[model samples]
Every structure is written in structure tokens, then in C-alpha cells.
Target: MPPPRDTSVKSTVIPFDPAAPNARLRRLVHHDVLERWRAADRSAHAPRIVAVPGGDGDDWAAAALVTARPHTAYLKIVDAVGDVPTAVEAVVSHARDRGLAQVKWEGWTVNPEVAALGFVPLSVPLAQDAESSGPGAGHVRWLHDGEVTEPPYYGQTTHFTCGAVTALVAQAHAGELARESFDRRAELTLWRDATNFPACEPVGLGVAVRRAWPSSPVTVLLDTERPVLLDQYPQDEQEWRAVLQRASREEAGRIGVPIDSHPLSMTTVRSALGRREHVLLLVSLADMQGFDVPHWVLCHGAVPGALVIEDPWTHTAAGDTWVDAHLLPVPDLSLDAMSTISPDRIRGAVIIGRTEA
Candidate 1:
């Protein structure tokens, strides 16, 4: 089993030091947390905790760190703040640039400043009545700083978790945690046959995994279109299996069979693969729920070799922009956002498993 999660990781404190240079904020938080860890009667492995920051541009960056896992952290900042309809969207766009999954704000009040930013006031503790003296109250007070733009603009605070955040942070890291749970050498892979891959008309992502990495299988955790496009093309269960079998036959490793019909549980998929194969391709996506899949595809994990792509016909302005930024030329490819060892490698997004630093 992985080593026990040291709760001491939670005790580390990241302070909001306004005097520090914009680029130096991350280092300052790291030093402060490390100092706290050293002073306590705790093991050296204790995770570091940094308080989320508020502001705009470099001065307004929020702080968070991966206490349990080194080389992991989440940061956010306000891009713009105004009382316009698109104000919140601006902040959301900022978070998205860093690949953060959620935008959190104290939505209970009607601060047009907050309202414009699209902050709908989450029911999080200390979320209401920013002045309330309660547990987690400090976080509430920190939200109201000049860094937020005026009028139609608002901002979201970033939080780091050794475990999970309800939204932005959680959405990005879930896949990392899922992948980390397995023994890498076990040769696990996440597989999704065309039947489970997402599509309005059953289009598989054109990319194919090289045959050698089966032990480190990709996890196909998606909310998918069901009954599968294959059901429409193939006549029977045998034919369905034949289609996938035919596709994977020439590959070096054996493709894992239907470990689960339920499609949501990778654990069930794991059970199905007990000794037969060491990979999992858990499928799930919004296309099945009768909704356009792209908006909620964030609900899915971006696993390496875990083939999840938007239906070609479903593309939109934002989706197209995303594809252009990441895979403009094609679909279903993975690239490391960070190419070297530095915080800037992760400067924009709260990503896990994308860095070796």
C-alpha cells in the first residue's frame, strides 16, 4: 500500500504575503510552509499547505500546493472583474487558461462586483457574510481585495488539496490520483472500445497506442454515448466483440474484455481484468445523458492513452479554441504542458501528472 497520508501535510500554512514580488509568491509560500513543518514535531514528509491568494495579474495570484505529492500544485488568479454579464466568464477563462476546473466565489450576496464576475456564491463554509467569525472564516475575508476588477468582474479563490477540492482543483487531479493508485509496473492500461468512446455517430479518436505499454494502461474514465455506435453497425454481441478484437488483434498485448457493463466503476473494470490484463478503459461521458458532451467532458479524466475526444460534429467556439490550443491539427493526442523543471511549467493550470519536476 502507499505510505500512510500524513495529516501533518494539512498543518503546513501558506501565508498571504503582499510585499513579495509577483514571481516570488510561490517560493514564499513554499518557504513559509517548510518553516512551519520544521518547527513542528512532525516527520519530514509532512505536506505543505499554502493559503489561496487573491488579486489580478501577477500580483493577484492565489496559492496552493500538493502536500502529499511533490511537484504538484494549483494556482488561480482573476483575469478581469466587472459588473457585466461576461465578467464572471472572464475569470472562468483565466482559471481555464491554467486548466482549473471550477470557479469558486461566495455567491450568497448581490455584490454586483461579485455578481459581474459570475460568482454565484457557493454554500461553502464561511462563504456567507464574509465577516462571520467561524471555522474557515479567514478564507472568506480574503476575497475582498482591490485586485478584483470593478463592475461586471469578480474573482475565484484557488485551494490546494492533498486529497480533493469540490470543483476546480478536484476536476484536474482526479485522473492523477486514479492513475497513481495502481502499481505502474503492473502494466495497466485504460481501454475504451468504439462502443464506449464518445460520438454522436461513433467516431473513435484516430490516435492509437503503441502496443508495448499495456502494463501502464490508460484509464478510459469518460461519460460516454451508450448502446454504442457499434450497436448500430454490428448485428450481434459476437460481431461487436469481433470489431474490437479485429482492431486490437495485431497489437502485442491482449485487450481487456468487458470488465463492466455498468461503465462508471473502474474498480469493477479492474475486477474484470483480475489476471487477464493489467489495463482499464473505463467509459462514461455526457453524450449518453442526451446532453452535448463537451461542456461536461470536464467530468471525465484526461488519461494518457485513455482515448476521450469530442464528437467532430459537436465542436463549438470554445471547444474549437481548446482543440486549437492543444490539438488544433487533430484530436486525441497528449502533450506535457511543462517541458522542464520549474514552477512556470505549471504557472497557468492546476495540473497533475503533467510534470516530472
Candidate 2:
């Protein structure tokens, strides 16, 4: 039988600093795992450690590493030697105090204690860990009284296929494409069709989507006349990519797809999502992942203060799974800031709408 819940036990939130390592945390979590946590914490959304005191007056009974997004707090690691329920209660209270909507626990194995505390199992895919057997199970407890369903998640098979995967996910969510068709073959094929050589430029991807799904309305928003996503390459490469982008713009015009020469504002994006339209946003991962790589994410839903996005690429080295990427609630201001990429502050998006009856 499991131990009874200790109401007297209280959990304390400790700010995690890799520089000044906590001796207790070091004792609880392994060295390698702590190193991984350190690397992940380099992001803007760094995690905190929640420590629960033991019933016998020990320094810690249970502890968890948690990070807060817009409307949710994600528990990346949980270590319990005493009252598990009380520790979870403290975590929930922390989330509540921050006005969060839910608490997600990344569980490696099935624990009845967490299940007893009302953490329902999420239907995530099995192949989360590419190196090991798997990152076992995932659970979530909603704090508020509302229903929020996550869109289907498909991790990009290759580094350059994020644009294709986001486009595919948007189509699948809108019932324009089959869910089963989100495979490597289709992903690579779409990437081949859409890519401006290596990266999928906004115009090229928008044109490919328009040609692939004629019924769905497609619109491209780019605030620049110069070549995008090729600043890292040589001048010759940039020239060729610019030419390709020009050709893609022409194709977009011929195909009846509107290429708006303006930045897509957050207000417009919110309004489009409200009308059940999916937007493919190009964002830099510097703030989120501590790197300045340009990536594509699909905006599918909206909460009160956040936009729900599906990032096709998972940071596997930082121990991220599909759970971390799918249905992620990013605050409006943060999304707006990240979506503006490059030194030129170039903004780009591809708006896809359902078929008109």
C-alpha cells in the first residue's frame, strides 16, 4: 500500500542556478541528468526546483524540476522519497499562484501516486527517445474547468523539414489531408518540392502548399523584398536563392495566392486563428532553445493570453519529446518577438484556411 498523504508537509520553490549548484539537488538527481538540465535551463524559460520537506523534518521529502510557459507549468523531473501527494499539491499551488491553466508531469514510468492525485495519462507517441528505449509516459492535470484538445503531433524527421511538417500538420488538423499520410516519404517529398535548396523560404513553401491543396486558401506574408533565410550563405548562393524566391513569388501570383508584402501582426494572427485558420510562423529559436536557428511552427489554437503552437522539431538533446512541442502555449508578446527573425527583423508567415463550401 502507498503511504498516506501528508497535509502538513509543505513544498518550497527554489530557483535553479547551475553556477551555484544546490547540494541537495545534486544528491537527488544524477550528474549527467543535472548537466542536461543545466543545458536546457540556458533558455529564457529556465526551470525551477520544487522541494518538499519530509515529515520527519528532513531538508527535502520530494523534489521536482519545473518550467513555466504561458499557461502551463511542465514538470521535467520528479524525485520523491516521502510525501508524493503533498509535493504535487505544492506544484499545483505554484501553478495556480502564477495563474496557469494546467500542470504537466513528464513521467518515465507509471506511478499510481501521481495518478491518484488526478493526473490523467496523455496519449503521446511511444518513440520519444531516439537514444534510449523511450521517455515513458506523460500526464496532465487541468487546474481550470475547460476542455483543451491538442492537435496531432508529428516530429520532423530531418533538420530542414520543419516547414513541410508544419504545413502537413495544419492540413491534417483542418481535415484537408489524411493523418496517416504524415510520414517520412511525404515529409521529404514536400520538403523537396517546397525547399529553396536547403531551407523552405516563405514564398516557396506557400506556393507548394497552394499547389498541393488547391481548395485550401493560402496567403503568404513577407515584409521584405530581399532574399530571406540565406544570410548565412555566400553572396553567390544568396543571389540564386533570391532568384528562386522571385520565381516563387511569380508562381504564387499566377496561382491566385495572395502574397501580402507586409508583416503579419499578432492581432491579425489571433483573428485568423479565431476564424479556425492555421498559420505557419517563421521564428528564431534563440530565446526558446538558446540558439538562433530559424524554425517554423504551426499556430492552431488560442487560449486567453496565449497562442497554441505545434513545433515540428523536438530538442532531443535537451530531453524534449512531442509532449513539449505539441499544443505549446506561447504568450502573445513572446510569440510576436520571436517570430520577427534576422538582423533585419524580417517577419514571415503562411496563412492556410479550410476549404470553402
Candidate 3:
């Protein structure tokens, strides 16, 4: 058999400090990329740098940048002068210590060493465009067994199409839409049908989904009566958007769609997922991406302490690929906090049930 894996090699974890520059880290990552990492560090999902010392103990033989969500840790960047296996081991150890369920590595390219360490390649559908494919391959290693079924991932081709992409993904998960049809054309078409100028309001998107697939049952939950996602627009623009939202709500009522005028609770969301229904949640990306912008995400499943979600938008600049966005795990507490929007604390969700035969 092959030589026993090295167990003696240990790694040191250092919190990334933008102010203090380390020669070892600089050698692995460029100055500009380091600045980007610093900005990400300031975000809620701050990353830490892990370094494994060389045999001579004078230089780092391997280094990796990593961050932890509620249930998983992402190996954002990795470089090894030698002993790639050791680097993987060090990162895995850190993830385990953090009480994470899995460790994800999105490599710039395929590396056999990572696969040798029991990291399985995540199934990514062929992208119609290069930007959706992202820059690299994604692999994940589970620390423990749990039910984490990932729905089909579809990256938004444009910035404003998250809502449409998420709605389509929810439909695909429910077998209402074909996975093959999840392309830019479908995305934009759905966006045009659902969007209130730029952003897709809850009622507008719900109405669009209901109209697109009549067999699929939809229920919209919103705690407010005011027009949402219009804060950035001026008075005249807001008025027209409000009128559209009002129209959408009226259409929803006429079509037998249940529009609940209350906040969406985690308990209710869990119940719906338990029934195999998908939830399109409106959340502020402040905690996840370090921004306060409202974004749409699809909730597909739930594990013991976390809920599984699919975020259509990926932070490509921070090395996030579809792996980071697909079936992402967020803690119950964190999801509840992020799902509550600001100013009015608006909580919105569109529950899409399985299509009827």
C-alpha cells in the first residue's frame, strides 16, 4: 500500500489583518487580492488564513484562505509549494474545530491531491456562458452525515435577475420547470414578467410564477402593505411601482393565490420544507455578503440546526463559485435575522408547492 498519510504536519491559523502585512501570506496571494480579502474580512463572513510550516521551519510550505458559514467552511484560496495533502488536512482540521458540517474548496483548476483527500467534486451543470461557470472546480468533504440535498443551481446572468433565477430554481426543484431550460433567455424573460422596473417585489414575483405555471401552488407572505424594493427610486418612480404592486396583489387575490399579511416565521418555513415545498425568501445580504441589499434565495431543505438555501448570486470577486451558492447552509438564527429586511423590518416569502398532476 502507499505510505501512510502524514499526521505530524500541523497548521497555524491566523486571523487576516489588513493593517499588518505578512511576507509569507504576500508570497502566496498578491497585494491587490489581499486588499480584497481584507474587505471581505470586514464583512460578516470574515476569512482566516491558514499556514503550514515547511520542513525547515523557516517558510510556509502551504497556505489557504478560509471562512465559515453557520454549517460549512469555504476554502477560498490555497497554494502549496509542496505537500498538497498536508494543506488539505490542515484546512479540514480547522473546519472540524469550528464545528462545521462540511469543508468546501473551490479550486482555480482541478487538483488530484484534493480528490485523493476524499473531497468529492460537486455536480455543476454545464453553463451556457463562461461567467456562470466561474473560474474553477468545486469540491466538498463532509465531516458528518446529514440530509443535504442540493437543488439545481442557476447563476443569474445579470445583477437584477436574482429574483427570477431563484423563482425558476424553486420551480425546477418542484419539477415544474425543466433544469435544461434554466438559461439566460428564460431568466430574462421571467425577470421581465416579474420585475417592477428593476427589482422583483414579492407579490409581483408570486403573481408571475402563478401565471407561468398554474399547476404549482403559490402562497405569498408579507408583513407590510407598502410597496417594497422601491426605496432607491424617486417619488414619481415609487408611485408607479406602488401602483404595480397594488395591481399584482389584486391579481393574486383573484387567482386563488393565498396572500398572507403577516411575517414569515422559521417554524412556518420549516413546515413548508418538510412538506417538500420551496420558499423564495427576501433577505438582506448584509450578514452573508456584507451588504444590506435585499436579495432572493430559495430554501430547499433543512438539516438539524440549519436550513439549506440556494442563493443565485455568487460573489465571484471573492472567489465564490456555484459551490458557495448552491445549497448553502445558514443557521436558523442567522436566517431569521437576515430574512428580516430593514427600515420596516419587512419579512417576505413566496412558498411554491409541488406541481399537481
User: Each model's C-alpha lDDT?
Assistant: 0.24, 0.74, 0.75
- In candidate 1, what are the lDDT values of residues 134-172, reduced to their tens digit? 111010111221221111100111111101111112222
TM-score of each: 0.24, 0.85, 0.85
At residue 350, candidate 2 shows an lDDT of 96
- Model 1 root-mean-square deviation: 20.8
287-327: candidate 3 lDDT, tens digit per residue: 77777899999988886667778888877555456777866
Q: Indicate the residue-level lDDT of 108 in model 2.
A: 57
Tell me the lDDT of candidate 1. 0.24
Query: What TM-score number comes out for model 3?
Result: 0.85
In model 3, residue pairs whose N, Cα or C atoms come closer than 3 Å (at least 3 residues apart or on different chains), thus clashing, are: 286-291
Off by over 4 Å in 1: 1-101, 104-228, 234-263, 266-314, 317-320, 323-357
| Candidate 2 lDDT score relative to the true structure | 0.74
Candidate 2 Cα deviation (angstroms), residue 258 = 0.6
Number of the top lDDT candidate: 3
